[model samples]
Target chain A: MEASGEVRRFAHQQWPYEPNYKRVNGWQMHYVDEGVGNPVVLLHGNPAWGFLYRKFVKPLSAAGRRVIVPDMVGFGLSEKPVREQAHTLDGHIANLTGLLRQLDLRNATMVCHDWGGPTGLGFALSNSDRVRALVIMSTWAWPLPPAEFHKRIFPWRMMHAPLVGPYLLGHHNALAGRGMYLSVVDRKKFRAEAQSVYEGILPDPGSRLLTWTWPRWIPLDESARGLARFEWLERELRKSKFPTLLVWGREDEVFDHATFATRFKELLPHAEGPELVTGRHFLQEDSGEEIAGKINRFLDRIDGKQS
Target chain B: MTEIHVIENYTPEGKRRAFVLAEDRVGHYPEFREFFVRQFSLGANRLERPGYVRASSGMIYALVFIGRSGEPFPDGIEIYALPDALEPLNDSDVDADLWALLRWMIAGVGGEWRVEQLDATGRLYQLSVAANA
Candidate 1:
């Protein structure tokens, strides 16, 4: 999915980071590789792309750290597979794994948000030696059932429905349209221009399949498609003894930090925060500078500890 | 068989509290509750404190507890349903979506279970595992 002229112009104005790409699984996976030093890989989640981290790349890199933010296949400027099954958890994990191996990003700090939590942590768990530290935002790494109230929410249930999900997500781009705005606490931050950049990447119904499949892929039970892999990742993450930092937006209506922060603390007991309280689900949008500052300090502190 | 006993309490201020008592006929309440909390996006800290675990959507808050069957534990899992949380369900379509989500949660447990919604208004929403299956 190539960025349209409008998206390119928007990127030029708002996000000026150098655009880089690598062919992963026969698809052009777009990423941002900036600065120079110990690598910091940023991962994004559903309804978003690498552009989600546009604000952080420059600051983190300027602070003497390389920042690598990749748009998963089916997102941003990456090639979108026509088939829904092609966007499986394994496929995403593989694409990222290949990209990291190709770049030889060793002892890197992984900063992840939303679905990035799972995919990034999934990578960390498997490649623990390569992962020096972790910065987790609003996301989960376990396979659990949806709460009753979660079902009541229109988007969660509607996106999973057989007929309705395809129509709303694929046909209308409902998530990119109204869903993104609803997820944020500060609505003004997600202005018309931002929406245009996101919508431009997913221009048509055919390009929206990845967005449609993500919500439906939430593993509600052991029987759900990716439950086994999620279970494995969860077990590995729980046992992983890496230096970790957790930053959260208290106001996130979806993936509320109050709900999941404690679990993350329990999993990585030595992990540093449930830091940054002002933002929403997309904390990058609300508190990107604060998050980046914290990341820099976290890196320095962990490096000091090792020395 | 895993039995999930749900107890609903209403305060004088019209606030609602929900509690869950998981009794495993096969003696796996702890395991079941652990898995249950993880799946429902319930915070593990609440297991040690009197805090509420908000769902992923930040709409539902559940105060969860785990114990052996017939151990004289709290009668049920207490859920605090804020007005804003339940407000969206005012629409009939969203209400149906809620039921579908509940049904999906029930199926995830994968056992013969029964959910008895004991509300004073006689709005009994019983979720029989077999029926949901």
Candidate 2:
């Protein structure tokens, strides 16, 4: 995790792009592929990284779009696996399926959020014909129903207590300091130069052990432990017909688009929107340019280039 | 002797709701910490304290009904009592002796039970059972 030159001059003064490491499973995976066309890919979650899509990677890479975003091995400027079962969820979907098979990101367009909705729908339910579209936000694929206020939540049961989830996310980092200011709803857009590049790439406690093992791998039943891969990603995203959209945040306070946005519009019913804006739960720090102008009008109405 | 499932509902503007799902226990379940400290007195909300932490596998209550000054309990209701299972955190509202003390603590801890009700526009309702030992 060596980005110092004052963290590469504060990531070139807050993301100027042009950094792109690979080497997935041995760690060193930072990313930001930048402009071209047809590929989007931004996936971030938990105390954030991939610099939380640095404002949708330069306006969707100046509108021509080829954005890609990465940084997930242990978060931004990658490489921090001081073993906590090597931060599993099958080791972050095998480091984002080996960085989309070492960058052969075909078709694409998979922007996600919050544990990037089961690691970007478990890599689009195992590369469903190279996932052409799907925006989704807030997050949840399935299996989570048993709430009493998640055991009277205080540090979300101290991050699911296994020795106080490694002493408050590995010795007092407290989820990048107080769970990133209580998961933003604009706390003045988390200023101080984005909390100094998010508490300067995990400054201590053995690099916050993947934000203390990501809320104890939140699956919450069907006898957890990645609930059969999110119940096979809710039965293949309910027969995925692609072109999904769902962009929530109607006051999230932890994924409450009034209780999972009508179950993600009843499981992607010709998935278009659960849109409902005015944010919280880092709705990309309260609407990152109206979520990149609704992902450029959902990729120009799914390539019919909008009538 | 393991089985606990209590579910009840109402919300589409009506208000009143409930949830308690823990079944066939496995690793940690002291009868949901004695049915959530006897239906949420939780030792008088932890002796009027509101924010807490114990964790080794139990106690992390924070039912703060609002009071932010150096912040921690931002909204309200959060519990994570473990022995087998009992997890609650932010969705709010529950307490009508929480469904008769989760059916008298699953018949005073005597095995297999299921009671359901989830339909605030997401069906999966009623499935009662308690008489077993």
Candidate 3:
């Protein structure tokens, strides 16, 4: 699905970055490349594009690292594939891999959040030599026992219902509509313009095929398809020695720091602190500056070690 | 006398706040609400948000509401204006088409109903409704 003229104009005005695209994995993947040094690849999660890290690009790039933020296929300014079957965990991993290879990004620092953790880390684990450091936040790479949050499935369960899922997510845009609002700790920080862009990008049901399929992609049980892939990622993450930072949204209602973050630390025991920041699901909107500062400091420490 | 109360309602596909026009009669609101709901082809196509319903004469109407927020709002019909509902041909004609539609709705729910605009403070005023309208 091509972005509407109105949505394109609004995104350009708010982000003000040169829109770059590369045809990777049979789709036009959009990205923002800034600075000229060791590459720092930022990957955004479901229902959002590269715009989620708008605040991080300038600051991180200015600190002397090339910042590469991709919208991923089926999101942001990227061409959205209408088929539900086109969106899958492996498909997304391959999508990211294709983009990285096209850009030939190596020894790159990976910053991932939400669905990004799996997509970005999935790539990092496969090509360990290409990934220098890792910053993981508010996402899971492995399946977990159902928590209290997953049990309360009033609207969430309804969203995945056979007929209802398409109507709510694909049509009503339930996730894109109120998901961000409900996820954010500070409503004021979730600007109206940003909200408009998120909601506006996929205006129709066909455009929202990816958004609708994502929630169902959550591997809940034994029959889940991504179970083996996630298990592989978890095993690889535990053994990997790349300097890793676990930055978590302390107040996140979805992926609570207490549950997911703790699990992440246990896996990557050698990884740096699970530095709890004040924010929610989409923490970048709430604490982008704070997170960026922590990341810059982490990078500085790594650079100092290399020097 | 038919008095219309405006309330703010939530919609994902449409605008955040809709111009909810409710009638004064208690028992008569369901009928009033149903009359307008029949106009738009909503549901599955749009959860709670109503899109423009084209008329036999090729005229388009944005009477897009049928749900309630549990708020103590006297229910009627919701008419979305500007940006989404009716794309006004020009800036100067923004209110013209809307007022004309409101007149049509008022005429449908017939009576010597005097229209008054409800403000944010719950204070009412004769802001848009003309004495002749």
Candidate 4:
């Protein structure tokens, strides 16, 4: 926790974005704001901060879209609360809501992945008027059964285990350390420098709780926390006519194409694709350039229709 | 004369669960006192009252303190420790000496044991195995 500033400095070295801060809730929330035009807001999931979308910022901004990526409260340069209770599905949505309202973002294109799926969709489903399009990747907004890999690995049980969970996750930084490494298809791309940036950002046991909470938050049934909101998301998704697109990490075992991406298509029936590209769970790391191209083209199509 | 008392209970599933009180304080035993002080600096002013929590799988592991026990801590399992200020809990410092202490304490109870903050003013010190040992 003491070395957090040094870690943030190191993170900025690789992340290479001018940091912006907004006082959302009590914590100083960190975000990246670049270019000018209709806003394209990007949200990252657990164990990932705005750094995940660093590759997209330049291209998307050059394409004349404002890029805004917020490091969800618990991750990135955002001020982290030591208590796990501070991180909840509803709490995150509220924080995102606070940021958007303060920034006065409207007619935005929302890009979501991993836990970003729920956090971004949660905001979008409720604030339909403010959003224009959505690009969903390797994430879920429904309360489906645990995915196959999740079932096989049983991350839920381990993450919640008393000493074991805290030791491996909160204490040992296993999720951000080894888990992030395994999240990609090409292990070569996940170099030690990048890994340190992820691990360095969370320097202590308490700082790692956010990563630990995301897996534990996976909804198992209707009684799960944030179930009602996700239910609302599932029920409301079809009704929304916003231009939608689906993309996936071809090799993702965690939220693989068959289960997650396919389900996304089923819900957003008219959505553009279940476009499978290179990478695994953290697909953005593996195929950011290729995916950015896909996103640019998708936005162009959306712009054509609007014009 | 460690003056440690072992409290036993059954989980809802009827698994045998146990915890220890070291003279109604943490570090009543010399070994625990030495390890916590060396690793966590149990004398630090910013932190207070370190304890552990029990999980569903019947494992006791996380380090908790007064006014800060958060999620993944299941209900009903009581923790007993001498309220003592320790060094900021870090992942790297948790493995060797702390793990050795945890393994030693759990060995007495047959699998799992928890230490908790019972009151704001009371200090729960080093726990000793009164029953098994």
Candidate 5:
């Protein structure tokens, strides 16, 4: 057999909240909606899914903030057709924006993490006012990776390969559950059910192709047309006057918070800022309640949704 | 006479079930996903709205209830224990209210007053109370 198909993992931990999985763009998108008032949209990035917000979702919603989280195509509960079409960063953003449009969510507070950078901004760039505030996490929005760090995250030597390439993704666990679990060291904090929910997302190896190939679309070169629109998006992010909240995990690996911290401050100078000391690229999972508190105070302080 | 609200893990047929009270009409919350993910020490709730809990160990079991209505749920409050701090519920541990516990959780949140953890088992715990932190 070319690959194994035994990925029946369960989020053994029960969510204090229930998850509502809906169909859209030919896939099932699992999201949680709580309370009413203003809507806060959280977009996750590569190898990661909406589950990243598992920690923050509850507290935010409990505080009367409507939280919307979607696992982009090929990730989480979204159907990953192993035999079908390819997953593109641009395509993922479009599908997510479509989800928002279909739901008719207005004045949303957009929060992005990792690959979420472009996904969150792509929509905000076009509908600036609808975006109440921008929360940029450990990721980037510019075209292509800086020549210095491209190989660090998206080494073509592996992604462009024909066969073993996909295996590398699953083998790393970062490409799958092991990788995600390996990143978090605290064992007691996570219940069997919580780990089950996160790992349950990936069903097989073929479906794991999205994780293998998504990094390839980082707009590494001119041949990638996506780079153009991304360049424009980055410029818009830098100039947009919307109130922004930038939270960086000081301990992030791929996205050294130190580097992006300065970048965001320069781009959105007046934005409210908070730093997570022991945080990782997945800050919400590492410190969800704390971040939700920061968001709560931020919203109340600046009225994040007031137009 | 006070209301005797009961939560049973097993029905008469021995099938396990979740008991959500009348005020619990909201059923399951869709937005509590992350708090479960992050495992924040203490989850925040409405000014006076508290949640419910049931803890059991071996032969000893304790039904815990806490509310944030204008009055405490049934007239009791609760508290936060250290992580994985599971223990048998003793008759001595059962009290009219959960003041010490709820206060501990609020103190963790930088607040001196918030939440009431009533270690109560009775009908009074069912009646809604006046507003509280």
Candidate 6:
């Protein structure tokens, strides 16, 4: 499925916000192709698109890294196809698969967050050869923790909930407010300017649902498909043994730091580094410059291996 | 009618109190009694010091802190929205949205407000809300 009218408007107006890139599949796929070297694929999560990596684009590129940030369908400058199926994890993986095949991205250093965790993991799982290293932040790839409401109302149940879910997500849940951005941030980093930029991208109600619907669609508990997908990726990570770096926000309000560590450690224990960052869920937004610096150093360590 | 119910008192330092508050029958932030006492001059006494922080009162109420980094600012306290005490604010019409729920969860509980499966894998969500500024 393609992006909906709401996300379409978002793609048209909100995008090209930075520089480089153009329309693909009637959706605005923003990308920065500069410097030139192997490639680095950065996938963002819900309530965000390719724009999330606006800062990393230039630096990584200047350092001779072909950084590719695609606003996955239903987010940022990418097309927001509202159909629940359109935004599923597997579907996204497929979309990314096609994009990678088309772009011929290889030896990539993936920087993933929130929903991007699974999406990026999915890519690595399938295209194991393409990945050189990974940087995961404030996100999870584990199956849903055992919780009832978390079981029922995850990204799936809540998205398709009777009257209540849609209303809460599509309208009442103003994407511009704290519901979308504030929730992920640590209290110490909350600021008006950052909030303004977030609110600025999403001016109308339609464009906002793209933010609200993301969490609702995650099949947290009984999502066999998502679980299977995640499991398959985990198996690959274990089998492939690709280097991975995890940076978690200790004070995160969404996914707890300890919980994130316990799960990721079990999955990628062999990976070089995984630390609980004293940041928030929106690590890129809250600590963008810091995160970029970390990524720069992390990738250099791996890229330097060949040199 | 304004309602104030004690939800917890188990700290060992100053008094630690949690209250279930109602505004026009609507549930808002769950405030700590001691902070209210200090900030509003309520003069409420703690059962003892560190009464609420160190001990578990065996109840589920939202925890609140006034300042960032879990600092308990005067009048900034915890409000325990007892399970039974949680009543639908609206019967005929509802203004509650995801945003409202997010705000209430943040203000009411210092952590995320997640409704998990009543009986399942224990899946949970850390209901993220706005800062208390």
Regions more than 4 Å wrong, model 4: A1-13, A152-156, B1-133
lDDT of 2 by residue, B1-133 (tens): 1222322221122212222221111112334444444444444563353322222222222222332354232212333222213334332222222223333433443332222211110111111211121
Model 2: runs farther than 4 Å from truth?
A1-10, A13-15, A18-36, A51-65, A68-108, A111-114, A117-119, A122-159, A174-217, A220-232, A241-307, B1-133
The per-prediction i-RMS, to one decimal, reads 15.1, 13.7, 16.8, 15.5, 25.2, 13.2
Across all candidates, the chain A TM-score values are 0.93, 0.34, 0.94, 0.93, 0.85, 0.81
Scored by lDDT, the top model is 3
Each candidate structure's TM-score, on Cα atoms with residue i matched to residue i, is 0.68, 0.30, 0.68, 0.73, 0.61, 0.61
Q: Give the CAPRI class of candidate 2.
A: incorrect
Each prediction's whole-model lDDT (CA): 0.65, 0.61, 0.67, 0.65, 0.54, 0.53
Q: Which segments of model 3 are wrong by more than 4 Å?
A: A1-11, A145-147, B1-133
Candidate that would win on TM-score: 4
Q: State the lDDT of candidate 3 residue by residue for A40-112, as single tens digits.
A: 9988887988878888988898999899999878877888886565788999999999999999998899999
DockQ of candidate model 3: 0.02
Residue A124 CA displacement from its true place in model 2, Å: 7.5
> Compared with the true structure, what per-residue lDDT tens digits does model 5 show for residues A1-307?
0124333222424444455655566655556566677899888876777667777777788888888887777777666755313566567677777788777888788988877878888888887757778888787877666334555312332222222133334322334454455445353454343455555566555566576566556666676647887788878887888888888877676567667767778878887775654576566667777777888788877674543
Better of 1 and 3 by lDDT: 3
RMSD of 2: 19.5
**TM-score between candidate 1 chain A and the true chain A:** 0.93
Q: Comparing 1 and 2 by DockQ, which wins?
A: 2
Looking at model 3, the pairs that clash are: none
Fraction of true contacts retained by every candidate, in order, equals 0.00, 0.00, 0.00, 0.00, 0.00, 0.02
lDDT-wise, the better of 4 and 6 is 4
Candidate 2: lDDT of B1?
A: 18
